[model samples]
Target: MKYVDEFRDRDKAAILVREIGALAACIGRQIHIMEVCGGHTHSIFRYGVEGMLPSRIELVHGPGCPVCVLPIGRVDACLGIAEQPGVIFTTFGDAMRVPGSRKSLMQAKAEGADIRMVYSPLDALAIARANPEREVVFFGLGFETTMPSTALTILQADREDIANFSVFCNHITIVPTIRAILESPDLELDGFLGPGHVSMVIGTAPYEFIARFHRKPMVIAGFEPLDILQSIWMVLKQIKDGRAEIENQYARVVPEAGNAAALRAVAQVYELREFFEWRGLGSIEHSGVQLRAEYARFDAERKFAIPNISIADPAACQCGEVLKGLIKPWQCRLFGSACTPETPLGALMVSSEGACAAYHQYGGKVQRAETA
Candidate 1:
């Protein structure tokens, strides 16, 4: 409780709030700062961080939720893998709720597909080891934070000579995605709250371009209330001083150099794809990772005959606009009325880390205020 209690203190939070307000007054214009991680977005909504800030400051939610950004077509591909006879499909709990063109993985499970909810790839490996005869496929997806474990799991499978195990790798990189956002003409971000977990794995060095070339300050932020508040203050301070630099506010957890062993493991197993599709953002160059040629034996896409089709999102769902910070979650026409956590019309409504889900769950006051 030491770090938790210390970070949540009202006195410290108020001091940071006062400092941020004082800095905002000097700038005397609207400031848009994007938080590039879904966890930070969740914290902002849960702690009512937006209400505490000056009205001039708008916290734009970027496409950081891996589950939220997973395209309908890819989910369909995952279902294609899941529906195959003798195949056991394993995925994270949030992924089960993501709607495909036809049905969700959860719906598939209900209809007798061997779909499983696993905490890690190792669990899927364990299932593969247990079954021996049936094919076990782990649905791998996310930014660099979760890649090392999946890579190491593949290494473990190789060591044990597990013939029935493979990974449906949808692993993506964060740098190119951020670069894409920065290049978009519609968004005019003043700074960024960089992803904490991904930065821990890949380090703060990769983000230098955000500050150096883009001229936008970025503070690698943590998920706690105080951590977010302080990070906001850091970004504001940088803007006040006309300094654009990458600073790590989550230094206790993330290092400037990153975890070398984790990077090594990730490099050992995966290589960048030429271009990969995202739900709303579309195809980004070098944005996704696939199992290297050497690890093709453990690659599910290679092992299975998949119908890698590209399906469009629903007509009413404005997830693409929301992801680009062009619109807020509540502004989406299908929000709350047609799309709820129980029945998600869009990927954003399915995951708790998603902007729509966080807003739906905790933005009651914000919704009423905005709608009024």
Candidate 2:
């Protein structure tokens, strides 16, 4: 608990596993728990936490990977902006590989588009400042965790009067996505392992709806192996006690009230869109944010002629089903063959945090063959 190694302690993990098993046995039915964060999905596979769980508990992967959840139309739109003459398109490296309708940003770069990967939005702003003559657009994406930084960076651009810089804001919200999943007709989730990173920004307050309305318990969890196992035990405890509540196991990093300054910056720079499309989850009302009209000068959508068209995935891709937790990554026929990380055909395989990418890297080979 004190250090990284402490959170990965095998002994402590074993104890929590046993406790989880004991509690899981009391439920007398299958316990389908969803880890509503892509980071948690990657950690579960990387640390082999899924194998450590009891047979009764199933940890379903959710649409928590912000990069993986962006719909194809959005990528196509980014591609259009990137290909424009004299425009410098900057985005996180993982996003370069997300398949656009015609080609990914990586492919576009190879074909002479000035697509550069930067660590943060500020880096894009710096590129804009350094090259006053060229248009610099940062392809901003992610949940609440990455929004504040982008917002602050945009504010800086405004203060500095960087007219050449703009943001292609594809930032989405978490609460609406979670609510959409819960509202799905066939969703079978028993409880949830909430995202730790997003919780640090938005806090545990928003998740009270899950417990209060849906009557499902959710524990905001950290990414370490022990943190995951302990959270699993915490969720199992609620099930055995017939309780529904939102608990924060990541309280050491995530304050219940959230980051006030970050929230303020985001509020000042952006406003909720009427609706936004997700790769697998489709359109969820107010699930994404856009630049406020006051910041319209720095909004890429308003600045550039983007082809904002909704696109369906490849005919063979089952990423939508996998994202909905209706199918495992390996269950998709294209998993390791046509859809390997090197030549990804869907959003899930484009990012490290995505469930399909995690499965292909850590496990699911034998199952993949069965489906293949």
Candidate 3:
């Protein structure tokens, strides 16, 4: 309760809001601040922060949810691996629900594909140890926070000489994607609420580019109401003062240098791919990681000749726009009508941190009325 209660104090929150309001009046322009963490998106919606803010201060969602940004082709590739003879697929719970071209991993499991939900990569390794006869493929997907754990698991597997365990790496970097977003001609963001979890791994230095080059103010914040409010206030203050910089609001957990051991572990097993496709951003150069040549034996893609096929997204699904901050979730015609969490039209609906699902769960009625 020490950190939790202190950050959420109503008085502090009110002060931040008052400051933000004053800052907004001075700026006198539509200040678009995008929060690049899906966790932040959920927190923002859950706390009704959007409604509390000045109308001119808009918070746009970015490609923070790894599960949400996983291209449809990649999902299909996982499904294909799951269907292989004597193969057991392991992935985090979020991936189990994200729809592929035609079927989800959950549906595939229901239809007897031997897909197992794992809390961590170590859990998948344990499953592989238990079933020596079957090949265990850990479908790895996440940004920096989870990648270190997966990298460690791979190292452990190699040390144990686990022949059957392999990884399908889809680990993405946060900095490059942020650079891509800023470089894009379409997105006109005033500032960014950087990902706190990612900052814990890569540190605040990676985000200095946003401030130095793009001249956008950014605050790496934790996933709490007051943490978010304080971050919003920091961004507003920067804008008001006609200054741009990267600030760390969640300093208790994130150091400027970040977790060196975790980053070293990532470097040990993986190397950046030339390009990897994202749901919204398409193929951004060196945004994804693949197992290094030394660890090639543990790489699932190398172990199995899985066809890399490119599939088109549903013509009507506006997930691309949602990820790029071009449109809100409710702006998509399929949002509540055709794409609820129960029957998600795209990955955004399936992921808990996904902007569409967060908006639907927390701001559906309010969004509907406003849109109507």
Q: What's the C-alpha lDDT at position 229 in model 1?
A: 98
* Per-residue C-alpha lDDT of model 3 across residues 1-372, encoded as one tens digit per residue: 886788667788888889899899998898889999989998898778888888888888888999888988999999989999899999998888888888999999999899988899999999999999999999999999899999999999999999999999889987889899898888878999999999999999988889998999999999999999989989999999889999999998999999999999999999999998887568899999999999999999999878788777678888877776788888888989989999887768878889889988888778889878
Task: Record all residue pairs in model 1 with backbone atoms less than 3 Å apart, i.e. clashing.
Answer: none
Computed on alpha carbons, the lDDT of every model, listed in order, comes to 0.91, 0.90, 0.89
Best by TM-score: 1
lDDT top scorer: 1
Model 3 / residue 202 / CA error / Å: 0.5
In candidate 3 the C-alpha lDDT for residue 208 amounts to 86
Which candidate order results from sorting by TM-score in descending order?
Answer: 1, 3, 2
TM-score (C-alpha, index-matched) for candidate 3: 0.96
Clashing pairs in 2: none
TM-score of each: 0.97, 0.96, 0.96
Residue ranges of candidate 3 with Cα displaced over 4 Å: none
- As a whole number from 0 to 100, the lDDT of residue 344 in candidate 3 is 85
The list of candidate 1 runs beyond 4 A from truth reads: none
